[model samples]
Structure formats: structure tokens, C-alpha cells
Target: MSFLKEISEYKDTIINRLLSDQELCKAVYYADEGFLEKPDIDDLDNLIYENIFPHRFIPDTTETAKTFVTISCTDYRPTGNSFKNGLLNIYMFTHRDLFRTDYGYTRMDFIMTKIEELMNSKRGIGLGELGFGGLNEYVVNEKFQGYVLSYRPVDFNR
Candidate 1:
């Protein structure tokens, strides 16, 4: 399962995208928790190809440069009657997993240099050595601390 990648390996890929004219500031939206994924594929490819290839960027991203942005997955719930009635009252948020209620959350921060090195294959878990928990979440090795997140579920809507 080659899906996990190091966040630090995409520095030049990102910095270059940021400087391009394609506008890398646009973010990917996860309506549920209102999370924003920066460096959206469009932001990255624009630097090299001038447009997002195929479509939105996913966990196993392909386009470089655009991969430098942070993609966060968060959990949220209703806050008041308005929220319960679907009144668009986004009043609450937390570090919970959208699907993994017991273990759900995300922090996309990673080193710049690491991101560049990772852009080579777009395969394997973090650093190419880790485990993906059955729940489609990254499982940290007791000894290695690497994030094995290849088990990520497919986002059909994307």
C-alpha cells in the first residue's frame, strides 16, 4: 500500500508553486469540518503545467510543487438548534477524525526538505516504511515513529 508520504520532502515543489502565477492560495474544502488543504494540486501544477491535472488532489497526490501545501482532516459537530436544523451555523470544531470518531484528526505540518525527496514516487507509507491501520489511518511504529497511512479510504465524491 504505497500512499503515505513525508510532508517535508516538497519544499522547492511548494515554494516554486507559491511564486508562480497560477495562484496557489486557493484551498481544498472539506465541508464537514471546514478544513482547508493548502497547496491544492492546481496551486502546484500551475507552477509547472499552468493547471491542475485531472482533478482535486488526494492523499496519494501526483502533481509536484502543489503537494507542498497542508491538507488537514478534522471532526466537527452541531452547536445549537440552528446547526441541528442545518442552518449553516458552523460554531464548533475539534481535533477529531471525521470518520474515526474515537481516533480522528490531522496536522499537515511537515519539513520542507523532506517534501521534495518524497515527491519522487508517491508510493509507500511515510518514508516508505510504516503501517496503515485497518481504519484507513496511519499507524505509528512503536520503534520507528513513521506514519504508515496507505490505508486511506477512497473519497468517491472527489
Candidate 2:
């Protein structure tokens, strides 16, 4: 199969195998990585879940197209016992045809340690829901390269 088709196939396989909420979230989290050492695959799966199925999830397909990933981070610490929420920064590079993706979230909430570690990491793409306030929401200032990623969220509902 072609590259995009293979990813789509993995997506379907993940959706099929992780039929429960908890299982689904965990599967999605790891699948987001989508690459692993062959012999080490089982070990990685075991580290995440108490089973072997996770090892078979990633497709070690070769890449023919150039690609880059966007880095994202949460805006704050977890509050109360509810699901944690945070803002993410997205970047852009000019391509003749740029594409936007939903990133279909896993309903997978991250603990403070996980959140901090992931946010600090230089690689790996994060998957999360679009927070309730929508893009019409507010954004505080922070530095990015030489420019600031400042923006006023637009409320499409308004």
C-alpha cells in the first residue's frame, strides 16, 4: 500500500483493536509514535500495557516524502480532578498545498509528570482535543524563534 493508505490502515486497525475507552486511549497514544525497533517492539508494548498486541500496531514503512512535525504544549497544570486542559502552539512552513489535520484525540488525559516531560521533549507530536473556548479564546505572550506566537482566539459561534 501507499504511505498515506498505510497510515489510514493503521488508524482503522487501532480503532478496531482498542474497542474500550481505556484501551482506545492507550493505543492511540502509542500509535501516535508509529515507529519502533523490531526486536524491541514487544518490550515497548509491555511497558505501556500488560499485553503483546501493542507491539504489532506500528507499521515500519519507509518514507518517500519529506516531513516535519509540530510541537505542542499545555497552557497550565492540572486543576481539580477533571480532565486537564491547556493551550498548544502550532507552526507552519509554506508548501504549495498546505493541509490541516484534526489530530483526532484519544480522550487520553496526561498526568503532570507526563505533560511536563512531553512538553519539554524536542520531538514527538501531541494529540489532544480542541479546548472548549475555541480559537476566539485568548493567548498570553511567549517567544518563538525571534517572533511571538500571539493571537486572539476567534469564536466562530459568536
Candidate 3:
């Protein structure tokens, strides 16, 4: 299959799988809000829900039950020959306020940890047939409390 088509399918698999989890659904915004200014922690309760998009923009930000998760499927520059491998970058976004807590672990930590675990676990079940390999790694951003998942589609031939 074409790498582009395979990556899109893999993204669909991820979105569908994550949306199935009730706990994740409550916290996850299912869209990226990179285009807008980050929401103020104080005003997080005032956001509207209609503006969220899969690439950039999540509008709901209610506190205590804030939808702070944005899942974006991004494309990176090909690392080698273009015909064989393709990378997909998935980002998980949350407010920086979620990075620190009385519990010492923080909400972002929990979410990012759980997400990486879930994605890796689902690799052979829900995602395996999509021609995707296991996650390369997940990283936490210093400023945004966002987690990034890097993955590759397997066996794309010219």
C-alpha cells in the first residue's frame, strides 16, 4: 500500500481505539489546538466545544473536567529512501497546569503514560493489521506538557 494511505489508516485506527475508552474520552479533546493561543488556566472553564479540529484547535477547556487532550497525526520528513518507510507523529496536548499536582505525579504524567501504554499494547491487536510498527518512543515536552508518539508504517514498497 502507499505509505500515505497506510499512515492515514493507522491514524484512524488510533483515534477509533482511543475514543472507545470512556476515561480517555472524558479527558481527550480528539483534536489539535496548535493554531490558537494556549488557554489560560484561569479561563479554562469558559471554552466552547465547537472549535476543535483534528489538526489544530480544541475549544473546550472546562476545569476539573477539562478536555485538554489533543491528538494530532503529523507527518515528518522521510528518514531514508522514500519508498520503504514513513513516519507518523502523534501529539498529545494538555495544559501546563496539568503537569503539577499535590499527588506529585501530575495528571499529564498519568495521561501520557497511559496513552503510550495503550498504544503500544494495541499494536498487535487493533493496530497491527494497519501495517504500523510499534511506537518508536514517546516524549514529554518541557513547556506544553504535551506527549509525542512517533511511529513508523512497516513494509511500504515502491
Candidate 4:
């Protein structure tokens, strides 16, 4: 399978896993086109109180009403001289507050851990260890927490 296809499939698997929880059914998103404009405080309030769990800007590409987790390709490059060995980085996005609340923290942790497990265990996808090891933190204007993960697809020989 092509690397892009593998990435897409990997994303679909994650979306399915998250949606298993009824609350998160429509909370996940894929930000392939880039992020939506930052909403004003008024809009933020509307999105939050209106039962909009996941926040999103572009309703056109987003699957659900709100956006909880946004997945995007961070980086893709060769790890070795040959194109056979390469590293793929996928960034998972969510509200920073999720990491503060007890329930949210646990749920977020579960999702992240599950993603790593699924990637490593699924031989077909060829996901290897993260670029470093654990989750790398990134914040977007105090609103979003981006967890950047590094993975190596299995070599063709393997």
C-alpha cells in the first residue's frame, strides 16, 4: 500500500476507536487543509455551551458538529539514504483544557496510548517507535494541545 493510504487508514482506525465512546462520536477531525480561524470569545461560548464537544472552523470538511481531536500530517521524510526507511509524524490536536480536567485527562491519555498501541500492533501499517519516545507537547495560543508523534513505517522487506 502507498504511504498516504496507510496514513489515511491509520486515521480512520483512530477515528473509529474514539467514536466508540458515544460522547466522542463526532469529536474527532482531520485538519488536512489547516486550522480554522480562531473564534472570538462569543463564538467560543456558543460552541462550548451548545453541546459542541469538539471545536472546528471549517464545517465543510469536518465530519461532526464540533471538533475534539484534529489529526494532521506533521512531517514525512527519509530516515536513511534509501527511500525504503522513513519517518512519519502525525499530530493529534485537542483543547488544552482537556489535559487539565480529571476525566478529560484520563480520556485523552487513553486515546493517545491506544493510538500508539494500535500503530505498533498493526503490522500492515508498519508503524514503529515514536521519533523520540513519549508525547511531545505543543500549544496553539493556549487553546489547543498538539501531541506530535513520530513513527517509522516497516521496510518493504519486512
User: Can you write out model 4's per-residue Cα lDDT over 77-150, one digit (the tens) per residue?
Assistant: 55555344344444445554344323434334544565566554455444443233346764444455555555
- Kindly list the per-residue Cα lDDT of model 1 for residues 1-158, writing each as its tens digit: 21212222222333343344222223112223323433344434443323222211232323222222332222223334422111100011112232121114322222122322333234332224222222122322221111212122111110
In candidate 1, what residue range of length 10 has the lowest lDDT sum? 84-93
RMSD of each: 19.0, 17.9, 9.1, 10.5
Q: Measure candidate 4: CA RMSD.
A: 10.5
**C-alpha local distance difference test of each model:** 0.25, 0.25, 0.46, 0.42
Model 2 agreement with the true structure over 1-158: per-residue lDDT tens digits? 33122223332333232332333223323333222111223233333332222222222213211111122233433434533334443221111111212233211212111222223322222223222222221112121111112111111110
> How badly does each model clash, as a count of residue pairs?
13, 6, 2, 4
lDDT for model 1 comes to 0.25
Q: Which residue runs does candidate 4 get wrong by more than 4 Å? A: 1-67, 71-83, 100-107, 127-134
lDDT of 3 at 90: 53
Q: Residue 8's C-alpha lDDT in candidate 1?
A: 24
Q: For candidate 3, give the lDDT.
A: 0.46
Model 3 ranges off by over 4 Å: 1-3, 29-53, 56-83, 100-104, 124-143
RMSD over all Cα atoms, model 1: 19.0
* Model 4 residue pairs with clashes: 54-66, 54-67, 54-68, 55-67
